[model samples]
Target: MTERKLKVYSEDEAKERLAKELPHWYVEHGWIRRRYRTNSWKGTLMVINAVGHLAEAAWHHPDITASYAWVEVRLMTHDHKGITDKDFQLAKKIEEVVQWQPGLEGGALEGTPQDDLRFAYIKYDKPKA
Candidate 1:
């Protein structure tokens, strides 16, 4: 199914954006948390650069914290007032770039243990004709 693109229409256009785009990341204290794991500080910086580029291109900005292993991004839409649509859009864009944990990027596996082990019960599988 296609995902619904959330709407944003507020004076604080940028703030509004965060509510939709980074639903999971955008939080209290007037900040959104975006976490990404990297091989080193250099890699982390590269991602920050990319995110910066994204922010600039979108004409929206975020406060970012970077370290050797991780980067935490905080987005707040300053123009429209509070959590505008643009913020959400940018959050989605940012989500495309970073990942914190492995094997859980998109989703987890859905098959039962029998799917992996041979001679195991395969209820999901049908008898061959």
Candidate 2:
């Protein structure tokens, strides 16, 4: 099959989309990036695996930088040579899955305990004071 041309967003358009739809993501050097802070290596691995799954499922991989306590995901369309809808879509899915807070929903799923750091993995972003 012939490769279809993707709509690559300009820098300004990318920034605007990020600000409106994905406040946590930022556009930089032709890529949209987001850093997720974790509590330990376990958390870092979890984040990486989650991102990998999403990227693979979406068929749009990201450049992942992972350390003991954090993971930075950078998305861009290589074929298109810029940020495209695929990047933003994958970023949103990754954000939703990686930062999910089931406990806050008051459902049967009680998310990991915040009281204990041992059980905790990802260091979720707290509201600014």
Best by TM-score: 2
lDDT of each: 0.59, 0.91
Please state every model's RMSD to the true fold in angstroms. 12.7, 1.6
Off by over 4 Å in 2: 127-129
In terms of lDDT, model 1 sits at: 0.59
CA shift at 49, candidate 2, in angstroms? 0.4
lDDT by residue (tens digit), candidate 2, 92-119: 8998999898998899999999779899
Best by lDDT: 2
- Of candidate 1, the 10-residue stretch with the lowest lDDT total is 119-128
Clashes in predicted model 2: 0
TM-score of candidate 2 against the unseen true structure: 0.95
Reference-based lDDT, residue 6, model 1? 50
